[model samples]
Target: MDRWAWANGLLDMAETLVIQQRGVRLYDGDDKTKFDSGTLLLTTHRLLWRNQKTSDCCISLPLWQIVFFEEQAAGIGKSAKIIIHLQVAAPNKESGPYQSSKYSFIKLSFREHGQIEFYRRLAEELSQKRWERISVPQPVPAGRSQPGRVKAVGIVGIERKLAEKRKETDKNISEAFEDLSKLMNKAKEMVDLSKSIANKIKEKQGDISEDETIRFKSYLLSMGIADPVTRETHGSGTHYHMQLAKQLVTMLHAPLEEQGGMMALTEVYCLTNRARGMELLSPEDLVNACKMFEALKLPMRLRVFDSGVMVVQLQSHNEDEMIASALETVSERGFLSSEEYAKLVGISVLLAKERLLLAEKFGHLCRDDSVESLRFYPNLFLTQD
Candidate 1:
């Protein structure tokens, strides 16, 4: 879950708060610096405080030990203070349709320094524990060193153990897919954890067994899996949801331009999604993406594949010149094959022929065919010289 972090100045960085500034600390959660007037945010994960007049840096606290103390409330005015302890909620990252949960002031003081003998109630007031302590559970000593504890270990997981997992019948495939889906959510975390562990191993290379470290790193690396269940930011789905796809749409332009005036729709999906690494798109997702792309009036088309190789491409729409150039490149080669012509400009024969026809209309190339071969050459009649 993402932690809600905010500062008084920039709303752009704010994300993951059950309520705006609700769980966000007004004191820096990350810094040791003392401040008289500037706002600081403190949290279990990161202390954040902002410097206003100059280059702003937010101080962050990374551990949960920092917390509220009764002594810290001394000399602060009542009107300026709103001291309330809430049952903290989940962190979310999105714009609207927010949530509201009930909270009560555990201790209320009329003024900061006033000793009016006011009340402070926690567990009984909310019917919930006000203070939570996080401590490691005490370990229980083993009764007798068991055979299992002293025994030499064999392979923990045998290949045969997962044979059933891999050998599911076609009917069970759907059910298997559900299990795969569950694994998908945790998959990304495993990948990230591996990187951390690998870095640790590298940091203490000589101190650790080299063979053991290498084997561990390889095993961890092999466990990488893409987790799509993660919400865009908050726990379910979010505002940055379409961000990577949007970026892919933008990145598709250069390759599209070189693909003659049109490309197969499927090709665009492969190329665009590959550029995104693990964030592959479904065909329908790719299509919808292209529709959004077309709305921008980009010189590209979402084309169908009569042959099942659909693509998205920019309208090199200057087909005539492209064909003319291809024919001219061939004519100068004195018998250059079609394969050679296609390679230099990065296109297929089908697209090249389309360009050639356009050039033919412009009188740049003349097609001649024999039983053995067919080819095009520059039109000497239209010679510039």
Candidate 2:
């Protein structure tokens, strides 16, 4: 259901009621003896009959199915009635030779004196629908002409159409860029500044590679944010922080998965702030926003080790699992260096060393720091051997 239509007590937003009358009688095709007493609603889209006792007991007759509406005066002391001709069934095949036309009828009687008004409104709305259908333009084949229809004149003869289309496209582009033209100009200036710096560095150092210069230019190009959400646009400091937290969580999913369900706070800050562009958040703001995640029951949390290195880690992350993985990796090759552990655990060398030291502390692994190269071995393997 459409929210607006639900709020308005309607089936769809396109439906509009022309008549809502209580104490109405509805009779189906050729069934004068059997009638329903209910409230009748006639809309531009459909006719609805709602039973007086049951809320969900209602029948619908779409306007498209209705073929005719004519007034019929009931006798005195009774209500006014209108007969609706409906195209519900196909022509009967077993009928007589002249019985090609087939239809059904519904009779509605209203106790109030607005039957004439209802008939006029229904007629007007149906006429408007017909007019709208007739006014729509139909496609014409190329190089073909009809007596009463417009024809497509092909590319050579449609200069006016091409100009109009081009004008419309340009207008849309202009509207979209009207607010960001200044920022775009500043971005161009930044690119020029980057080129000048690159040239100066090459002249002085003679060691700056072309790849580095290209990377610098690309970074300069990525600095300007096409769309940034700030307090000014999102309203209130609290709302801005909440929105930023949601964006951070969404962006961290891939990197966290790649980094074994955790990432250094420093890396997340740099990446998220760079993506945010001019509306970068402070470290404190990021921290506060992350604090709200616990209350919001998000899947991740902020973790600070004894050495004061903060990280974003999934709540499901387990140190025991990390240690088990480290033990398996070291036992597989008989030993693992810091670089090998980093590759095995899918984390940076620094983080990998931290986990190795922690595992050594817990007696899960033993480190051999020799002059040649430092390596780790599973404690069980070392003990068994």
Top candidate by lDDT = 2
lDDT of each: 0.44, 0.67
Against the hidden true structure, what lDDT does model 1 obtain? 0.44
Error of 2 at 96 (Å): 94
Best by TM-score: 2
Which stretches of model 2 miss by more than 4 angstroms? 1-229, 234-239, 369-374, 381-385
Q: Across residues 55-125, which tens digit of lDDT does each residue of candidate 2 receive? A: 65665655666677888886878667888887644442222112322326767776544565567777876
Backbone clashes in each candidate structure, one number apiece? 26, 0
TM-score of each: 0.32, 0.38
RMSD of 1: 23.9
